[model samples]
Target chain A: MTNLSAELRQYLIITASYWTFTLTDGALRMLVLLYFHQLGYEPLQIALLFIFYEFFGVVTNLVGGWLGARQA
Target chain B: MNIGLALQVVALGMLMLPSSALTVAWVMAAQGLSGIAKDLNKMSAKSAIKFLVTDNAQGTLFRWVALLTGSKNALKGAGFFLGGTLLVLVGFRTAMVVMAAALAIVWLINLIALQSDLGKSASKPKFRQVFSKSSAINRLSLCRLFLFASRDVWFVIALPVYLAATLGWEFSKVGGFMAIWIIGYGAVQAIAPYLTGLRAGRVPDGRDAMLWALPLAAAPALIAYTLNSQFEAELILVGGLLLFGFLFAINSSLHSYLIVSYADRDGASLDVGFYYMANAMGRLIGTLLSGWLYQVWGLQACLWISALFIVVTAALSISLPRSGSTLPTTQ
Candidate 1:
């Protein structure tokens, strides 16, 4: 019973951490879009910002995968 | 499951969730589902091929592939139209949540349906087994990198910049173009099983089949790039996109073949996650470089670079060895 409770606690902690990360990420994205809009960026410019964001994500994913493979 | 059943489930979920949440949730869920789907589709390819090659197998393979691909295409198109219409009518938040919930439901149903299809087995190598062997690890990593470089990063980063700078398209127009491109792409994939099945009888060998399709599939982009007028550009873009979709479908099928073959030799599921990570990582690099490339050299240069990358990828695809005959067991 105690072990099960510990497992549940661990799961809860992980879930909470994940949610926090997601929320923060989403909020940052929203803020950036809003900021761009305020700067009078056109729709294309806003889209480009997202493209830039995705570009960074691609790099991180690549490096992360490489590291993960190396670790494995 | 039938297309009707899938649509019904999606519609129900759409009704239940808020619009904004539905859109956001659906897109996220779709991305994850796509990842899982890629893995499963690869795993299933061996069986699918076997079904195709074996005589008197009830044509079950063809039917299933057709159904799966068709349903996916129809569902995606429907989902997009539905989501857009919902956003216009109800609001974005509701659409987001509803779409997410709908996708989650579809994924659950798919999970149940696929459970029985995956054969019972302990086929995969242990993590320790894979890690301890240097050659196995190196080969897997290299192949993963190649797969990543071939797809995700290259197109996603280059295409938008290519349009904006070369054509002076507004962002909204680019978005519309992208939406159309994706729909056309998915539609092509949905029909790919039929097309490939027809071609399978003539090719005999896997490698030859993929090699032959590579350039033919890639030619549309170059053709599109040649057009000068805006309307002509849009028409060529759509045509090129359709070709791109066909090329990707073929590439995906071929990649699956390669991955499964590799898995059979090394006996591990580490490749799946590693492969996905590689693709995602490439996207990151491509996206970042694309921005810089645009700022420095403009759109035409980016297109040329993208075209060069595709040609290189096509060349590499020809050299991939055929070895594995079974799916790698997932951990």
Candidate 2:
């Protein structure tokens, strides 16, 4: 770790953060899925919980691309 | 910093909420916010990878890309089980608090340790350049849309809910199966190039893409038929999903490689971003259809729609150029 270049070290840092984020994100989905179902929301109703989640996902990808390009 | 702050806020809100406040509208709103945060993190990390790898080694590039994505997915599978276990051990509100605290730590680590100027470009790209001009890119993006929709249509909303509702499986059991399903999917993704013979020095081409995707359409169709036929619903659906996951992983890894390969070195994010936008749109479409179809008809309808989407994906793949999106139209 000490001998690696700054670029490689930075890469590892970003990758680690990304990995942790994914873990929490997955956990969040399961938590929501089972929690709502436990509360007796119908299957479709439970599914509706993520409608906005997935919809806004499309919005983010487009805008995030542009944002990534413009970043200084 | 901003996304982390926002996620922490949302998590805290969920942590302290009253039972009566847990309306469909409330949870949906929260999920929407989380979705935005997820994509922000995803796009940034994916864009960052191109910078991390050496330009000359296409093979190493492919491997790194697959490794990053595959490992993230495997951890995500673990997260599913973690979520279930947390719920069982600590219950909902406490689980939210614990996750929020952990994420806050991640945020702090990233803030202090990672370089601030990671993906900044020398010349800022104009907003109008956001859309890809390459017809190959446009065509591949279309294929991506249908391909992801094909998977999410059954995977996202319908499957876990169905297991719990129809089969009378417990939440732990549903989560466990899903964790296994996703872990297997991610594992297949990690080894896709090998399965496709990347070792043979064959970088995946459109023909490879089509061949990988063609068999996928059949699995869902068969699964749906078996369920409709009432031939041991649990075994067929679960087993069928595992088969579907394997094929879908290969098809998806091929696309992942292509999108990175097709992207312009400068503003690579622009192309990768456009492609994933389509991917997200597919997920959006599939998620909605999964809920509505499962509610109105059953998982059978979701499976059928999935097969239809895959057929469109295969159609689009047939015309893709052999290499980069820069190639002249094969037509």
Interface RMSD of each: 12.3, 3.1
Q: Write the per-residue lDDT of candidate 1 for residues B248-313, one digit (tens) a residue.
A: 665555444445445555554442334545455555455545555645665445455555555555
lDDT of 2 at A71: 51
Give candidate 2's whole-model lDDT.
0.76
Model 1 bad stretches (over 4 Å): A1-72, B1-177, B190-194, B197-206, B209-213, B216-221, B224-231, B265-272, B322-331
TM-score for each predicted model, relative to the true structure? 0.49, 0.82
Residue B189 of model 2 has an lDDT of 81
Q: Give the Cα-based TM-score of candidate 1 against the true structure.
A: 0.49
True contacts kept of each: 0.06, 0.80
TM-score of chain B of each: 0.51, 0.81
Regions of candidate 2 where Cα sits further than 4 Å from its true position = A1-16, A66-72, B43-68, B108-126, B129-131, B258-273, B322-331
lDDT of each: 0.43, 0.76
Q: Clashing residue pairs in candidate 2, if any? A: none
Q: Which tens-of-lDDT digit does each residue in A1-72 have in candidate 2? A: 453476677677777877877787888888888887788777678778888888887776666666654552
